[model samples]
Target: MDLRDERELEVTRRKLHVLEARYEASRREPDENAHVHELSLRSLKRMINQLKEEIARFELQTLRK
Candidate 1:
């Protein structure tokens, strides 16, 4: 891949990593804040899923070039 493609891939990977970390943190919430934690966790999960889809599309586009 070219330099631009490599840079884009790296940025996407970093974003995925950050989202995963946030999801992990949300998963470790205590029972005292069940309602809030649940909402936060769900939001994080959705973001992670979207990011995964984005990565897949990016990879497919790169392969087509």
Candidate 2:
């Protein structure tokens, strides 16, 4: 991978890590309101999925280069 691609991958990975940590923390916290907790978890999950897709796309692009 080129320097720019490597840097981007690193940043993406870090973001994924942070998101995962937040998701885990949210899961462990007591639910004050069922609806709000569910919404928060869903949002975090969606963001995590998007980041994962981005990382996969980046890797594939790098591989083809």
Per-residue lDDT of model 2, residues 13-61, tens digit only:
8988999999999999999799999999999999999888888888888
Best by lDDT: 2
In model 2, what lDDT does residue 58 have?
83
lDDT of 2: 0.87
lDDT values for all models = 0.78, 0.87
Model 2 compared with the native: what TM-score? 0.87
Candidate 1 lDDT for residue 64: 90
Residue pairs in collision within model 1: none
In angstroms, give how far residue 26 of model 1 lies from its true place.
1.9
Which regions of candidate 2 deviate over 4 angstroms?
Answer: 1-4
Cα lDDT of model 1 by residue, 1-65, tens digit: 22246677788779879989978876875768789888888888888787778778777878999
